[model samples]
Target: MAVAETQGIEPVDLAAGSEIDEYILDDGVFKGGMSTLRTATNSVDKKVMIKFFVQETSYQRELSSLYSLQKAESRNVISLIDYFEAEEEDEWFPQSVIVLELGTVSLQHWAHGKRPVSEVYLKSILLDILGGLESMYTAGLVHCDLKPGNIMQFTCPGREQGIWKLIDFDCACKYSAI
Candidate 1:
């Protein structure tokens, strides 16, 4: 794996098999506006998704939002497993990393090239999204960047259908009552 020099901060291009601490990157990197995501596994080999924020502001925002949501413990929202800063001296590595529950698929990818769903199924998906929004609102935060790509589909062990949950929160902010 390529390491960044300490002279100046550089963007690290992570590849499959790259290990960051105990988590190992297992798939291709998915780049977003504020961060990059990768499918990884923890020390015990359980699958997880890791997010590396590009900017300090974005990292702090998402970390705060996740911490608040963690207290709320909403089933409609994605769960944060662990978080930490890279200990490596390489400036190319992202300063902040967040480990999250891996989803079966992103809503955007799940919807692509698929047939239209029943009204009940569509309503279920909408209701799940609404539930997530309600949880965020109740937690005094607003997800400013709601989109299909930010929604994840997960399937529980005993459930037949998938459950949709809100994921990204870098664009989220707190709200105060009037």
Candidate 2:
């Protein structure tokens, strides 16, 4: 399938828009320790996952981590699309949104189902994930939160399928050079 296509899944009504204030929030698809993951459709109906932070500090941490990852330029790392902030009526006043490339299912979901993976396939994924971590370390960044839920599995054919992506860098921190 094309990158922009989502099979038969219709674009959700996120009250979506291009700007920060113009965009709308929809129900979260996944909830993490510091953020809730929601689907936001663009003006062109393209779907992107948005990470809404529960606190301003968490947002800052994630934003900084993503910036570091962007500088690392690792193919095994998840890509950052865009980010924005929207006003909230609740205690979380200004909600920070981190836009990202959408993935089908997380490794956590797969593991939860107790699905058996071929040894070769498991090794391939581990190697790819380690490569990403190596790149982060080389760039002086440490991924503090490395788990299945934070890892995205891409099913694209050929080379794309070879490397799974590491995500959820909110807890990632910069370490002093050794």
Residue pairs clashing in model 2 are none
List model 2 lDDT by residue over 23-100, tens digit each: 334454666678777775665666678787778888888788778878888877888888876455533234667888
The list of candidate 2 runs beyond 4 A from truth reads 1-28, 86-93, 113-115, 157-162
* Backbone clashes in model 1, listed as residue pairs: none
Task: Tell me, by TM-score, which candidate is best.
Answer: 1
lDDT tens digits, residue span 69-139, model 1: 88888888999998877546655564688889999988899889869888888888999999999889889
| Root-mean-square deviation per candidate | 2.9, 7.5
Give per-residue lDDT, candidate 1, residue 44: 97
Worst 10 residues of 1 by lDDT: 1-10
Top-lDDT structure, candidate number: 1
What lDDT does each candidate get? 0.82, 0.70
In model 1, where do residues sit more than 4 Å from their true spots? Answer: 1-12, 86-94
| lDDT value, candidate 1, whole model | 0.82
